[model samples]
Target: MYKLLFAGLASFVLAGCSDQSWRTTDIGDIMPPLDFTLTNEEGETVHGEDYRGKATLVYFGYTFCPDVCPITLSRLGDTIRDLDDETRDNIQVLFISVDPSRDTPEVLKRYTDAFGPEFIGLSGEQAEIDAVTNRYRIAYEYGEENENGDYLVTHSSAVFAFDREGQAQFLMRDSHPVSDAEADIKRLASQGG
Candidate 1:
C-alpha cells in the first residue's frame, strides 16, 4: 500500500512540473523578458515597464508595409475583439515600426487607430530600434528605393507574447489561427502574470 501511495505522489508531482500546452511555440524559457525603450504614437517616451500590468503582444513591422503588416494587425485585432471584455481590456498590441524614417508619430497614431484602441504604435531612433529588434531576434532589411523614392522593408513576421509581468511567454506566427491567438491571450490574462 505504501508503494502505491509513493507512486501516486510521484506521478502527481511530475504532472505539476509539466508545461502548459500552448498553441504557439512556448518561449518562456527561450526568449528574454519584454524590454525596450521607444516612443509612442503621441511622441512620448515609453519603456517596456510602462505596460507591465497588461498582457502584451509585440509585432515588428512598418506602417508602409503593403500586405503582411496590415493582415497581421487585422488578425490580432480580430482576436482581441473576440475576447471577453475584461480580457480584451487587459491586453495590448504593440506595433513597432521598422521604418522609423518614414513612420512618424502622427503616422503611427493614425495607422494604429485603424486596428483598435488596444493597438499602440511605437518607433524610435535607429539605434534604439536596432537594440530592441536584436534583443528579440527580429530581422529586417530595406529594399532599394524606386524612382519615386519608395521602398519596401522586409521584416520577420513573428509576434512575441508576454505575460502581465512582462515575462516572455510564446511566439505567435502568421500561420496561427485567430482563435488560437485569442485562447493564448485569454490564458495569459486569466493567469494575471
Candidate 2:
C-alpha cells in the first residue's frame, strides 16, 4: 500500500511540473476571424480576410504620435527582428492610424516603412476607422488643434496578436518584454496555415 501511495504522489508532482500553459499572461478571450476593411499604404483597398492564413500583429496609432506609438512600434520591430527567417515570413505587422485626418496613405506608408519591410500601414475615413476600433474596443480621443493645426490623440496602446487560424490568441501590452512577444509569435507561426 505504501508503494502505491508513493507512486501516486510522484505522478501528481510530475503532472504539476509539466503544465503546458504559456508563461506570459494571455488576454485573448475573444476567438478570432475578426473582419475589417481598410486602405493599405499603397493607396489600395485591403481586407483583413487577405491575411487569413498568416499570423498578424495589429497596432493602432498615428504617425505624429509623440511617444507611446513610437515606443510600441519600435519594440515590435525588435521582436520581429529577433524571430527566425521562417517565422518572420509567416508573420505580418500592421500599423493602423487613428488620426486619419492627418495620416494619409502616403504618410502612413512612410512612417511604417521606417520600422521594416514587413510592416504595413492602414488608414481610412473616420467612420470606417471607428468601426474597426470599436470592434477591438480601442478608445481614441482627438485633441483640439493648436495654432499650427497640430493636435494630440489620447488612445489605447494595446497591441493584438492573431494566430494563423485567424483566432485572437494574445493581447500584448506596451509593458511586455520583446522576448515574450517573440515567443508568442513563434508559437503562432508554428501553427501553420
| Candidate 2 stretches greater than 4 Å from native | 1-20
Candidate 2 per-residue lDDT over residues 105-192, each given as its tens digit = 9999889889998789999988889999998889999899999999999998888888766667787776767677667766876665
lDDT of 1 by residue, 1-193 (tens): 9999999999988777653767778899999989999999989999999999988999999999999999999988887887889888889999999999999999999999999999999999999999999999999999999999999999999999998899999998878876777778778766754
The prediction achieving the highest TM-score against the true structure is 1
> What's each prediction's TM-score?
0.89, 0.86
Candidate 1: stretches off by over 4 Å: 1-19
lDDT of each: 0.91, 0.82
Cα lDDT over the full model 1 = 0.91
